[model samples]
Target: MELVTDQHKKKAKTILKWLITAGIGCLFLFLFFILSLWGFAKIQGPPPIKVPQTTRIYDANHYLIGKVEHENQNRTWVHMDDISKSLVNATLSIEDKRFYQHHGFDLKRLAGAVLADVKSFSKQQGASTITMQYARNLYLDHEKTWMRKLTEALYTMRLEMNYSKDQILEGYLNTIYYGHGAYGIEAAAKYYFNKNADELTLSEASLLAGIPKGPSYYSPYHNFKRAKQRQKIVLQSMVNNGYITKQAANSAFHAPIRLVHKHKPMNRTAPYFQDAVESVLQNQLHIDQKTLAAGGLKVYTTLNSNMQKKAEYWVKQVINPASDIQTAVIAMNPQNGAVEAMVGGRDYHKSSYNRAVQAMRSPGSSFKPFLYYAALRNGFTPSTTLRSEPTTFTYNKGKSKYAPSNFGGYYANGPITLAQALALSDNIYAVKAHLSIGMDQLVKTARKVGIKAPLADIPSLALGSQPVSVLEMAKGYSAFANGGARVTPHYITKIVNQKGETIYEWHPKKEQVLNKAATFVLSQLMTGVFDKKLNGYSKVTGASIAHILTHKVAGKSGSTAADSWMIGFTPRLVSAVWVGYDKGQSISTYPDSGYAKKIWAHFTESALEGQPKNSFKPPKGVVRRLVDPKNGKLAAKGCPNARYTYYLKGTAPNEYSHRCYKEKGPENGRKKHKGFFNRWFHWFH
Candidate 1:
């Protein structure tokens, strides 16, 4: 028995020796791995701690309009002293009770989390310490891989070695997202309560502290009830962790928290206009999205606050909100292309699709001015007559037949002057002119006047069958208003860096596109649209505007089955209004409702109230001649349709009217009319 016992003891000793050797080897391997990881982390260095600053946008009057954060991370860094103590306590109590006691991690909490995850067969709990969270947010991407976890551990150790406890807490608080596009305690306080972080009360702080765990799930703006319930949990954690007394926690639980009901004021006064300006900046500066968001730019736009307000007010008053009709308005200086006001849609909060700049719809008869301008370039005068009758245009060598008719099949069936036809929006006359001058000339004319949409070389181009944006229409009409100068529409007048250094400034480019005489003639012809007697038609397309304001104005009205448009301009300002449904549904079957015209009149009347009234200045080459409207000839005193019309030099009528002479008896015979230039010059003097 003694010999057996000795053998057993020897076997046990051998097993013990092997076990100790294995354990030592394992320990050495573990130490080596840790040392290697630490060395690698040291070589990698700490992650960048820079937080993106806010970019502010200002209007023409230097009033704050809006703000954008870097990469949508709306964070504002705050020091430890600037943050409320309650927030720190609540955050630490719920997130990591042993935050200050641990070097970089809490092993006890980590063990519990691992066990729980194993039991659930999924990672349902996170035991990351505040320092770990800060390390991951600053240094590592949010990945749940084992390699990522190891890297995070190394980064956490480095963070703990470098930063103090308070600094780690401040960094964590500032880097964490708190929903509603808010990152950091400062942004959370402002977004949720419209107050500063230091001004947050206990209830507000607790609520904000609970959001970092699951920002979207516990967002007060999305689910207030869930947020409050989470707040109760955070308060209980604070009590259990001894950060606050039970009584204090209870008081906070019952404290009434007044959350901001309305959307946090982002200072966005003209969201649509700001969007346009941002797009320009992106293209002009060749900036990426990240640079634009956090670049700390001070964008000075051409938005007039008063004009924008007037536009919004008029839109709300004229259109019913419940109708779900989309409307867009753009007002700009015709001389410089400085956008004064812009309304992209009816409700920007509901839908941010800017119809003014993005939506491409048919301009309908509003496109006729470009067609007429082409005709004028081809030797067609305002007094030149065309037969306003049903016409069939052949395309593809008669494979396609397009018969164009007037609106409601109402045609004069006889010759009509170009001015009267344009004022009346005669489809047949426009189509005839389009065929006479060819489609390329009309397309070129539209392009010169700032129509950027793709226009087909079809005959329907004359009747506005091509789609274009309201902004383009406004810009195109501005040529006539500015005496044939092509102005590029722009919103941002200047852009400055954060340090108030001018980085970019807008210089208006005035390109002369047409002769001043042609532009003036067109402008004068458009005035007849507002004068029913001058148009000599039963329905003047834009006559409604004449009753609203006494100022001299010229505009055109356009409509399709699904869209309605009214674009007008004075010498100083050009504005356009479009009303339609997003789904391409017709507004009303009746053409005379004139909803678009009424909205335009209301907005323009208010917008142009204090502005000076100016008229188009005729260039030196333009000559005024009194001619018979029936024929392009000199009129006698008794001529019925005699009116003073403008013509380019050398384009005036050279022959006297024989019919008018017959009506005025032999006293005004051809012999008496000899040397007609001398006689007319004497009468004019």
Candidate 2:
């Protein structure tokens, strides 16, 4: 029995020994297979995917625009130039000490890490080398299992063999997520210091190097204490590894952490305009999103950044704050429709709704000028005053009433000259003038003068009750800009690609809107609004400062209960500004003229600071004369009501067509009698 048992035990030992030997052999074969497969993978290489090219935004002048970053997604790209060697060394020391010296599977490190873990583990054991981390990031899970370990090792070997060191470094830096919407070192630097990564200090580099292990936990924005602690670890590792001196490491560790302010995108300034330009360029010109975002495109835009800034500032400070105010501003070169600036909102961040290009607010009194323009085409000289008193008309719907009241409260009765009616913004005068002149004619005249909105057939249409864009109003006013020539605001002057080839070029075309004579009379009459009706500004008056401010200038003010707007221009430069809230309601305690005028003053003052004031040159077609403003006829000497007026050179007044007429010459036109309505509407006149 003893012999039998001993024999069995011996046989079992021998069999087990053989099995163990075979198992060892099988293990070696498996490891060998893995190595060979990994070697093959090294050659085959990981596939390279095209990262979404970052898009860069720029100012209107075509300078570098900021980048568009994605939140919680890898949206940044960094290069070797943006990282420091010390950062690399520090990361390696605390992560895996034998990173550079080993193959993918560092057996020695595994054993050491395990031993340390068993001895005293604070948290996760450090068995992952930089290459292993990269491999895990590219492909694999962070599971604590032998299978995951083996796969990570295999992938690491593949990564090391497939990619160049620089490429690996770039990918690692760029793909690694940093908390606070930062993806790469460059972005992090911009977020932390308002600068680029290449400009970071040694302390900053060390602080950032510590973020990857636990981004959110170590973020300076949310967990400053943890971030500082992590930074200390990184600094200590750097010093111990001789990447940095003890003094440097201590200095870095002691440095205060500073987080950067939010970078509100510059893409916001003229979102609608930019959208229009980019869409046109992309659709019509075939430009792609990649080139638009990161190609360092120098888009020489028609926008005047300063004026645009002023317009936006005004809307924000003076308009949007009002509960119900909404406004828009569009300044263009009337000679060629190049829009200088367009501001659509008070707070773009809060809401992207654009009011400038998209809103449809009623024009109110602003539409009245088109009627006068039509009347001029009908042979009514501005010197020909009709009446300023309240009057009712039956038009539009026969049953509906058309009674427009002057916002100034009262009106002048019959015999009020055309010049006086306009200076007072008389609704009755405009209604009568347009009714006699013809509504269809008024619509055509308004269109020719740049009013692009659909007009009502009713008499109210003559008073600017139609909704119009600030851009359209600016163009309408431009009839006086270049002697009746049209101005159309357009963006995207030129579009180029990465190769610098012009994909598209915009050459603005200015057309004739009104004849020189009509334009001249309107301009002169428009300028007269400043005399006394708009007088008493110790230093400023919209009528006087907008037109004849040491130079030939002219403009008009428009206001609706919900919005306040002003469009003014000099012969050399024309600037139109609008101010109000996003929602169209009565936001102003008073009216828009005051606020709009002030904003206009601010914009014009800054924009026209250095340029020589310009004067309007009456087109060769205008005739000039001085006459009794009471009637469109010649006035007598010592006539207190005399006023200067312009007529088209070929269409001068019949009474004064022989020569230039001045008020000083001629017999007494009529017995001068002071009128009652003039007391308030035209106090000084």
Candidate 3:
């Protein structure tokens, strides 16, 4: 019996030893599997937690104008400390009760969830920890495929190995979509409760905590009863997790909750200005729309709010709301090329096509400034005379006979000074000057002055027949306003990242492109459009709105069959306005024809109201001479139509007009010409 007992003890010892050895081997295999997963996750790099932040836009005064709306990522990141404590507690209690205790996965809950899913013969029961869900949101798509799940698991492991529990929690709260185009807790709080995340009450916290499970299914905006039921479940979970007492949970569940009205947020102020800024960002800065939307950059624009408001106001006040006639206005600072105000269309909501920068219409006489400036560069003073008559010009080696008639067929019938031609917008005089200077030279000069639109080297171009945008016209005229320094139009002045680092800042450099004397001479000649004294066969083109000028303004008015344009500038500001139909329909209505001038006059006056009345100062190389408008000669005593005309220092007329003195002979060795056309045309050839 003793021998049998000893043998039994030895057999039991052997069995026990084998059992311990097998258990140890199984434990080692499990550790090896976990280490393999950890290695793979490490090789996959850190988890993606970069959240798309909201990009803000400001005016020149640093006042918030609006925020750029990226797809559905209406998120504003806040620190964990800025979130309500109750929200954190409620979220953790409902989302992952063992979030603090586990590294990334909770085995017990995962086992229970697997068993339940197996019993139900489906994968409906979820065992995702907050870290796992965050990984899924950040890295993988929400497809229920096993590959996505496995990828999510790897990312979850990566996040746990790299970031702290607090970091994971904060990122999770900030990135989760909460429906209604709201991403993150802060935007959700604002959309649902009309309050900030830090200001949420216990009831609000529990209510928001229940939304992430199925945002659309449990949204209070979609189904309040279901959302309340889910909120009750979240409150009970908090109670069970010891985050709140049962009595406290009950009180929170019954607390009165106020929800904001369900509507799309209307926080944007200047829609057209915002669109223009985006255009500059894409076209000039080379920042694509997708990156700009998600970059979280704070853009500071050169927009003056007061000027923008006045521009819009005048546009609305001028054009009838019932008509289809559209108007575009642009007010820019000529000193720096900063676009202070922009009105793209009469109504932006109806049509977003920006006429200010997009629509290319015939500039008519508005383009004559560039033509006359080119003439000035080619040794033509403001007092230079051209025969303004109805004449057919033989061009293309007599193959093309171009006949450009004056407006209403009213011409000087003899000769008119360059200033009077500009004031009356004489087509014949413009064509002669354009042909005399060589057509291609005018195109080059226009481009040099910042006119980027394609120009045709034709005789009609002299009469402002080329199609150009209002913005290009404004930029072209900026050189004249700023004393010959060319400037590029700029909207955004600075761009800063979310980290308060400046990514871009505009330091405008003035490239001197035009002759200072020529630009000044042309600028002063432009003022003749308002002077009734320069009116010859017809009144000055700007005569109708001349009474509205409160200060010195040099500008021109242009009219085509389909388009009407008024471009002018003071020393500080240049405004270009265009009024026409979207489809090229001739402006037949009297009111429609006058819209450009009215809008320009009102907006310019209002914009310069509180500012100094600055006058255009002539450059050093320019000389002022009192000259006769009828003939390109120096004024003598008792001259009928003598006015101060600007000229390049050496180009002022030395020969006194025969009308001044009854004698027509050589004076001071200056021989008198036989005929005006014979001598002037001879010199031109």
Per-residue lDDT over 273-369 for candidate 3, one digit per residue giving the tens place of the 0 to 100 score: 8888976776687764434555678999999998999999988888888999998999999999999999999766566688998899999988888
Error of 1 at 607 (Å): 2.6
Order candidates by lDDT, high to low: 3, 1, 2
Quantify all predictions' global Cα lDDT against the true fold. 0.82, 0.66, 0.85
Distance from true position, residue 605, model 1, in Å? Answer: 3.0
Off by over 4 Å in 3: 1-52, 70-267, 282-295, 636-641, 658-685
The RMSD (Cα, Å) of candidate 2 is: 16.7
When summed lDDT is taken over every stretch of 10 residues in candidate 1, the lowest stretch is: 665-674
Which 10-residue span in candidate 3 carries the lowest summed lDDT? 663-672
Query: Per-residue lDDT for 211-270 in model 2, tens only?
Result: 878765788876688888888888888778777789988887887766664556544456
Q: In lDDT terms, how accurate is model 2? A: 0.66
TM-score against truth, every candidate: 0.66, 0.58, 0.66
* Candidates 1 and 3 compared by lDDT, better number: 3
Model with the higher TM-score, candidate 1 or 2: 1
**Model 1, position 247: C-alpha lDDT score:** 93
